[model samples]
Structure formats: structure tokens, C-alpha cells
Target: MTVLLRSSTTLAALLLLLPKTFVLGSVKLVMQNGGASQCQTLWAKHTIAVGNVCVEADQRNPEQLIVSYETRDGWKLDDAHLWIGRNISEIPFMADEPADDSKRSVQQQQHQDQPYQKQQQVDLTQFPYKKEDLAGKHENFGFVVKLQHLGYSCPDTQAFVAAAHATVTARSSIRNGNTPTLQSAWASHIEPMKKHVLQGATMINRINQWQDFNFTLVCDIKNDPPEGAPKRHFANQVPK
Candidate 1:
């Protein structure tokens, strides 16, 4: 009886110490920025690639903000730098990519915990290769990005990391009861484009008011191979 009870106690302690694991299909998100405190587990969108969607409402406003993941399509967020971890994340959409054009000095780039392989942030605004290079290529599976007032602008960042999981808090409001829909919120972030004849360097459309946020994304690379390989080189292999 003593030995059995001791074994049971040991097993219980071990289970308590185990790190929780979540499958790709199940993920929960909590946000305190929508005028109230809330946490929600996001539902996976019906697609082969890694993307998800959820609808949330903010207090003192008529509309809710649409949160979605952009693993491949819809990666751009107007002219802002594409993802987190970098100072400026503006991605490239119009320029021609050259081969062997790796930016970010090895010493300067930051590193996050596993699942998120280091050296994930590549140059987005300037291309060294063509879109044809990524034929049938898939991006990493998990990344929850929140674009604030982003629109259909040229050269958007494909992936970025937030300091933590999804959460946004803002104190300002236009309060037109706009009911921030996916299409409407996206349209609100759009900037005027240049005429075809006078296409030139990219310009930015600044928001009238400044909204501050405190959150970060922990973006994972499509490939996390061993032996210090860049994310583009391997499958989802990371240190055990």
C-alpha cells in the first residue's frame, strides 16, 4: 500500500510539471483591447494552409473588429513594416527579387523560443527572387497577427511576431457606430495609389490619430530544421 500510494503521488507531480501542448487545430486567444476584457479560442479557417479567423467586439463602438491570420495570401498591411521583431516591417510587392539577397546581420537579428525558429524575418519590401520561386511552397503554420487600420496597400509584410499572444487595448474612438467589419476595416486602411504613368517610390498614408498597443507576435517559420539552417531550408524540425 505504501509503495502504491508513493507511486501515485510521484505520477501526479510529474503530470503537473509537464508543459502544456496545443495542436495546430486548437488555439485560444484573449484580448483586453476591445473596450472590455475577453479571451477566446480561435477557430481554424477551412483551408490547407495555416490561417484562422474570429470576430470580436469593442465596447463604446457599434462594430466588431475582424481578426484573421495571413500565412500566405493577405500578408500585406498597407505600407507598414510587415511583422514584429523588426523595427520597420514594410514588405515588397512590386519590386523584382534578386537571388542571394539576405539582409540582417547575424548578430543583429533577435531570437525567440522554439516553434519560432530564429532568422525568420527576411526582407519583405525588397525581393531578390520572383514569386515563381515559391511554387507550391507553404508558410509556417501558426502566427496570430492583428493589423490596426491596415488597408490594401502595396508591399506588405508577410509575417511578424508580437511580444505575446493576441491582445489589443486602445483608448480613442471615432464612435460613428461603423461596426468595424473585415471589408470595411480593410478599406479604411487603404491609401491612394499613384497614377500608372508616374509610378515611383512608395509613399505612406499616415493615420490622423495615434493609437498605441502593447502586444507582440511569435511568428514561426515554415521550416525549422536542425544544424542551424535558415527557415527556408527545411520542414518543421526544431530542437527537442
Candidate 2:
């Protein structure tokens, strides 16, 4: 009777191990551009494996993403500020602060002495909003939001203050329909913010990875006259 009971349990377990089939479907890539797909190529180059799908892109020459759009009234963007961020780790420990010898290991000292540098790359397509969306909270601000790094000089508090002034000036210029020459000029202003105590700059215990800092910036766009401008159409610095 014990042997028979054991046999019955084994059969029940085997029955529970039956195979289940799943329906398979393929999703085609709707290439927005006629040529080879840039997103597909980037995913392939990165080999950033996802679920069961594989993507590929040109390994040698990669295309950059540039943002261009038209407004309802047919206003086209010839050029706009492409927000960028710097990898703060790009700077060497010795370069940021040479006196802190206790923290810089032997390997770090060697690396600091070398001339290796990190490249600055921007992902313009990875924008904050859908490519086609015309209305949103972000749209109201008339500025694009992005993760960017700005360059800064250490031991320079006044430089940081200057950055703030530059940012406000650029935004004001954009609103007034004046031509803004350089995007990096504005980025330089924000560079000091990363080192600013408020941004949380931390040193890693390891030697390979340098300290990392993140920053965000928004573009400004408004044409309405200021409240205090001498002319009704122009807004003066003073509030009306």
C-alpha cells in the first residue's frame, strides 16, 4: 500500500510539469527617417540587450540628434540652445584639489599626471517631451529641459555668481527675439553649480571612478513685453 501511494504522487508531479505555449508577435520598426535608423544603430552599438530583441547601428560613424520643430503659426526653429552637462569626473582629483594627498591614491596620482580626457556628447533626441506634442506644462515654459554639465574653475566663487547672471541674461535675450550666439556660454554659467555645495559633490572610495555630478537646465522663450519697459511693447527692468 505504501509503494502504491508513492507511485500516485509521482504521476501527479509529472502531470504538473506540462509545457505551456506563448503566442509570438513581431513589432516592425517604423523608421522616422528614410535612411538607416539612428536609434536602432545606437542600440546596436551599445549592445544594450533588451528582452528578446536585438538592435544595431553603425559602429564607426554615429549621427547626432538635432531638435527642430515648427509652431502652429509656421515659426521654425533655425537653432536653439542644446543643453549639455559635463561629467565632473572628467577633472582629476589633483586638478580639483591637489592638497588632499591622503585621498588620492598612488594610482590616482599617476592618472592625474597623464593627459586623458573625456569627450562631450549630447543626446538631442532624448528630449523631455514627445516629438509631436504641441501642448504641455514644459511647453508653456518655452525652454527645453535636459541633463547637462557645464565647465567651471575651482576656487572661483565669483565665477559661479557670474554664471547666474549669464543664464538670466540669455533667457531675457531669447524672449526679446535677440540672437543668442553660443549655447556653451550659458552652460559655462551652470558649471559652477555642480561644484556648489548645494549640488552634493562626493568623492568615491575607489580609484577608477572619479566623482560624478549631475545638473539640469531649461531654455527660455517668451515674446511679451516687460511690465516696466518705457515703451508699452518693451519691458523695462523696473516693474510697472
Candidate 3:
């Protein structure tokens, strides 16, 4: 079973470790020239995968927001989870540290030393969805929720955080039919695995394979003035 948890400090550190000239899949992270109504773009970083993320206020309804994620060739996204709040720590999935202290330390050191390793490793035990829920379903990858939905509103500025994870597979492994579906394995193993982890299981018999793309974007909301409001006029231009 693959288990993964990242503390907020680690997430912040990873963000800093990313290259200043990082390139997203198809979209580049650059300043948007249009007004607040325009879509804002951000870069997502991972060891083996690249992602492009976008957030924008819906043109049809300013109160709604649209968030989208895209990946480059040779990689497919399995699932994505989003959290909106004032800070990254507010995200539940990112707030928890690994239960094992030694493992955490080693993993942290490895990541710090080699931030861009070619091999992809992801932990999806905490993720809620099954593969069938997202695989091959293009629309499920993006989110379209109201600004005020679930009491999260775009008052002035808010942080939009996303965690997207997927598994990397080789054609030879699949041709041999030795590869197992992550969700299937997760479904059958999670319960027992949880017990084992809580009991301090330390077996590392299989190679853990998964990739995570994480990013954050700050959104600024600009609402038009209310209708029927009195207009301001210069003293010289007043009705005379």
C-alpha cells in the first residue's frame, strides 16, 4: 500500500525548491493583462509530471468560479482535490505529517537533495475517489463551483490549492498483466493497511509508484458596483 502525507511546511519548502523558470505543460506562468474578470494561470510542479492550472471568475455569472487542470504528453491525471482558504495549512490533506518520524526525515532529505528525480512516487491512501470515478472522464478533472459555495467566498483574496496524483506504469509491466490498478489495490488493502500502519508496519516489499502535482494560486475578486448607486461628479460639471 502506498501512503502519503505532507505537512504544510514541506509544501511551502517544495514550492521554494521549484525552479524560477519552471515550465508548465502547455501553459506558461505569466502575469495576466486582462481585468479581474480574466482567467489567472499558475504552474504545478512534480518530480516526473508537469501541470498547468487556471482559475477564473465565470463570465456568465461573476459569483461563480472555474478551475481547470491539464497535463502534458506521456502522463495522465488520475484525480485532483481542491481546497480554498486563506492559507495552505487550512487544507486538511496537506496538514498531516507522516506517522513515521524516521521515514519522514529520510523522505524530506531525499526530496530536498533531489527535487526533480525522474522516477515518480506518489501516495494516495488519503485520497477519497476511486480510479473509475476519474479515469477517462475528462470533465471530472476540472471544477465549477460557486464562489460562496460551502461558505468560501472571494471577499478580497483567497488561496486556491490543488493536489493531483497519478500512477506511472510501464508497457512491459502491463503487457505481462502484473500491474494492478491502484484504486483496486487501495480498495482491497486500505482497511487492513490502516490497521498495519497504526500498528507500526514497516514492510517495504513493493515499489511505490505515484506522482503528485501540487500548486496554489491567489485569486483577486473585483465586483462591479451595486445598481442604482449615486454617481460622483466634479463641481464644475454639476448640473447648471
lDDT of 2 by residue, 148-170 (tens): 12232111111111110011113
- Please report, in order, the local distance difference test score of every candidate based on alpha carbons: 0.24, 0.23, 0.35
Instruction: List, residue by residue over 86-170, the lDDT tens digit for candidate 3.
Output: 4434334434343443444343444544332222323344443224345523422456755456344222122344443333222
Error of 3 at 27 (Å): 22
Better of 1 and 2 by TM-score: 1
Give the TM-score (vs. native) of candidate 1.
0.18
**Minimal lDDT window, size 10, model 3:** 184-193
Candidate ordering by lDDT (highest first)? 3, 1, 2
Candidate 3 accuracy as TM-score: 0.41
| Candidate 1 ranges with C-alpha deviation above 4 Å | 1-25, 33-81, 86-240
Sliding window of 10 residues with minimal summed lDDT for model 2 = 159-168
- How many clashes (backbone atoms < 3 Å, residues ≥3 apart in a chain or on different chains) does model 3 have? 2
Off by over 4 Å in 2: 1-115, 128-139, 142-178, 181-191, 194-240
> Which parts of model 3 are misplaced by more than 4 Å?
1-45, 94-132, 136-140, 150-155, 158-240
